[model samples]
Structures are given as structure tokens and as C-alpha cells.
Target: MKALLMLLPLTLASCMAGPDAATRAATAPQADAAVTISSTTLSRQHWQLRDAVDGSNRRLDALLGLPDKPLQLDFSADRISVSNACNRISGSYRIVEGHLVTTQLLQTRMACADPTLTQRDTTITTVLQGGPTLILSSAGHTPLLTLADANGRTLTFAGMPAADAHPGDDGDTAPQQP
Candidate 1:
């Protein structure tokens, strides 16, 4: 009877010793540098920007002073769209090897005395020049964006709120209760 009791605990412990199902699922192949981001779901994946730091200098952050806007990145086969923050910029893009190159970037002509937007535009252009093999991560709880290199070196990026384009009085009041 004592041996039976001990054997019951031993069997239960052995069953629990194996890995959980979640751990085993992540054993899939890692994304390679050459993986092309083509589909809409892949393009709309949330990307929080990380500050691009070079040595001890913060060039992009110094220029734009962090993003005050929420932006959406919508990419297709040959073009990329950036909406929100009072600007809807679209342009053609090409991937060379694993790098992303953008050209003919045209944005809405709404005038803003703030120089930050221009600086941000420059920052985005420069980062994309490093190719499309960029790594992205969440920036805390903010909708911010972060970009990194193949070797895990982070580049400069920012997240901003999309422009207020609601049909009614904009996003001013809370939703009415049911």
C-alpha cells in the first residue's frame, strides 16, 4: 500500500515535468533577413519606434524631439502609406536585397509652423535607407515605434496618434452609453 502511494506521486510528477504547449510552439523557424513583408496583416502589425542611438549621440531624437503624433504604417507591394497626425504620406518603395528604399514621398500640404514634423520626415527617410531588414519592438505602453538593425542595433523611430478624422464632432466626447 505504501509503494502504491509513492508510485502515484511519481507518475504525476513525471507527467508535469514535460514542457508546456506554449513553449513547444515557439520552436518554429525564426524570421530570416530576407523575409519579405507583403501581406496586409503583416504590414499592419504594430511597430513601436525606438530611439536611434549612434555611439553617444541621439541625432533623430534631437531633431524631432520625440513623436507627438500617432501614425499608421500601411505597406503594399510597391508603396507604403503613413496616415494620422494631420499628414497622409504615401510613396513608392523598393527592397534591394533586404534593404528598403523609398522614393517620391508625397505628403499632405497642410502647413505647420512646427519644425518637428519636417525633422521626423527626414528621420524616417534616413532609417528606411538602411534596408527593410529592420527589427521593431513595442515602446512601453505608448503607441510609439522602434526600429532596429540585423545585428539588433536600434535605429530612430517614433509613434504618433492618427489624425482626428471622425465623422461627427471628432473624438471630443466620450461615447454615449447603450
Candidate 2:
């Protein structure tokens, strides 16, 4: 019930979404670079954090800037909601100058058990607000979404279509409610 309340705005926004959003994410495996990206395409799956790294390939998942759980991103027509943030994080998003930009970010005031998580909201907020480069591609059968900031840090997500993904399908230790 609580989760539903958090998602209500996203649901409403999606109802107002366009059939498509401006296309383009980033480089892919040669052939898929030209793949089209629409609001519909983006909202098609539940993107889970697969890896977080820097240009040096240093893993940064420990500083996920949220609760100790897999980070999940959901897209509506023009809005994006973040899960595993302890509190809900959402806002309007758009493509500007070939980058994914998030604005008007709002987060619930719910407290988190981990001080590290709570204190790092600024980290994630800063990243999202930085207008990171968006890249979408696929590996075999699964879709991959990547967001890279100017600082060379990246957040890559693995797409899991709602119809094809189960609660524990990809070794989810902490499952977030929708």
C-alpha cells in the first residue's frame, strides 16, 4: 500500500505520456547503436543496477547513495522514479543536448537505518542532476541501460521486462515493492 502511494504520481504521469519520447541513448554493440528510444521503450522494463563504475573501472556499488539494495529505476512518460533509495526519489526527466537530465527531484522524508544511505542522497541527486550521457544497448537477450556522467562515473542498469522477470530472478537479495 505504501509503495502504491509512492508510485501513484508515476502512474498518472504515464497516462499523460507520449507514444514516444525523443530517440537516442548512446553507443551500442555496433548494430544496435541506431536503436530507437522512446518513452515507451524506456518504460518497457524495470532497470536494475548491474554495475557502477568510474572511467578507471573502479566499482562503486558500496556508495550507491541509497539503501543497501539493488537500485531500480522506473520511467513514466516524462518522469523517473527511483527505488532502493530508502525514501522515494522521483522527478521529471528529459533529454537535453543528448544527455539524460533530471529536474525537480523530490524525495520522501522517511529515515533510513543506514547513515551512509541517508547522507548520500546528495550524491545521487547530484549525479542525476548532472545530465549524464544515456546509453542503451543489449547483451544477447537482455537489454542494458547505461548513464555516464561527465566525471566518467557510470551507472549501468540491466533491463528486466515485467512479464519476464520474477521477484528473485536475478539474485535480488532485497526486493523492492512497486
lDDT assessment of candidate 1: 0.50
Evaluated against the true structure, the overall lDDT of model 2 is 0.73
Quantify all predictions' global Cα lDDT against the true fold. Answer: 0.50, 0.73
TM values, all candidates:
0.46, 0.66
Off by over 4 Å in 2: 1-33, 63-68, 163-178
Highest TM-score scorer: 2
Cα lDDT tens digits for candidate 1, 23-125 = 6667853654543333231243333344556444545454435454533465655787765434567788865554567786787877655566565555555
RMSD of 1: 11.6
Across residues 45-93, which tens digit of lDDT does each residue of candidate 2 receive? 8888787887788987565554336678888779998877667899999
For candidate 2, report its TM-score.
0.66
Model 2, poorest ten-residue lDDT window?
A: 20-29
lDDT for residue 163 in candidate 2, whole number 0-100 = 68
lDDT of 1 at 47: 37
